[model samples]
Structures are given as structure tokens and as C-alpha cells.
Target: MQFLLDSADRQRLSLDARPDGALTLVFDEATGEQASVAPRTLLWYKLACTLPAKLPPAIVRDYATKTFKPAQAYGALLNTLGPCR
Candidate 1:
């Protein structure tokens, strides 16, 4: 999973798999950190940007109102800012 932030630098997020089969967020090649998150949380974040007015029908039916890890089917969000000068 990946996200191209709408910022001046066009920051990017890259989700990678860990040895234990859990999804992890990777930025700037750093590792050894926990990156677990709820599937709905990630979906809501995306919908917030694409459809702030209302929830998309598909998303509502599929992701909304769910409370499970579903780790195999979901990944966490990783945010990073541009390097400082």
C-alpha cells in the first residue's frame, strides 16, 4: 500500500511486509518499528481526502462498521515530512 500526499514535496508512503506476515509502514528505509492499524481507520483516512462530503457506497458496505485486525487484508498509514534544510 502507498499514498502520495498532496504536499509541496509530494511525500510518499510505502507499506511493506514483515517476516511475521504483518504489514509495516516504511519511510526513508527505516525499520524495526510497529506499524499496525485498523483497516477502517486507513480507509476512512483515504475517504476523508477523496470524498469528504459522504462515505463511498462500496467503502461503507465493505469496511465501515468492522472491528477486526484483518491484517492480511489491511495495512497501516505511515506519514513523513520532507527533509529539513
Candidate 2:
């Protein structure tokens, strides 16, 4: 998953899969800093920016009320983010 932040500097952020199969957050900066985060950790932030706000109430309610194990939630988030290149 990739994002172009809407700030004055317009930073780029993406979730990339490393050659070792580990997931990493890649920052497109001069220093090329990268970090790995647990799926549960990512869930704490509102990571679903691609979702539409106009979704139906029932769908929204279902999403909000649903429970998931850490790994499951992470898989769901990955699905929402779509496939990484």
C-alpha cells in the first residue's frame, strides 16, 4: 500500500514486503528510513483512509462492531490496502 501525504512537503509512505517476507513501512525520503510494525500496532491508527465515508449505516455498524483477532485484523487491513507491488 502506498500513500502520498497531503502536506506541504508531500511525503510518500508505503507498506512494502521485504525479500524475507516481512512487512515494512517504507518512507520515501532522502535518508530512506524504514520500520516494521505489528499488525495490531497499525490497527490502533485509523489506517483505512481508502474507505468511503458514504458507506451505508449497516455496513459501517458492522465494521465498527466486528471483532477480530490480531492476525485476522491485520489480514483484513492488508486486504483493504490492496496488493502491494
TM-score of each: 0.27, 0.36
How many residue-pair clashes does candidate 1 contain?
0
Enumerate clash totals for all models, in the order shown. 0, 0
Give lDDT tens digits, candidate 1, residues 23-64.
445444455443553345663344334422333456546754
Clashes of 2: 0
Query: How accurate locally, in lDDT, is each candidate?
Result: 0.39, 0.47
Instruction: Supply candidate 1's per-residue lDDT for 39.
Output: 40
Model 2, span 1-85: residue lDDT tens: 2322233367566665444445566665677786764444553133434333244456445655346343344455456444432
Candidate 1: worst-modelled 10 consecutive residues by lDDT: 76-85
**Residue pairs of candidate 2 with colliding backbone atoms:** none
The model with the greatest lDDT is 2
The positional error of residue 80 in candidate 1, measured at the CA in angstroms, is: 24
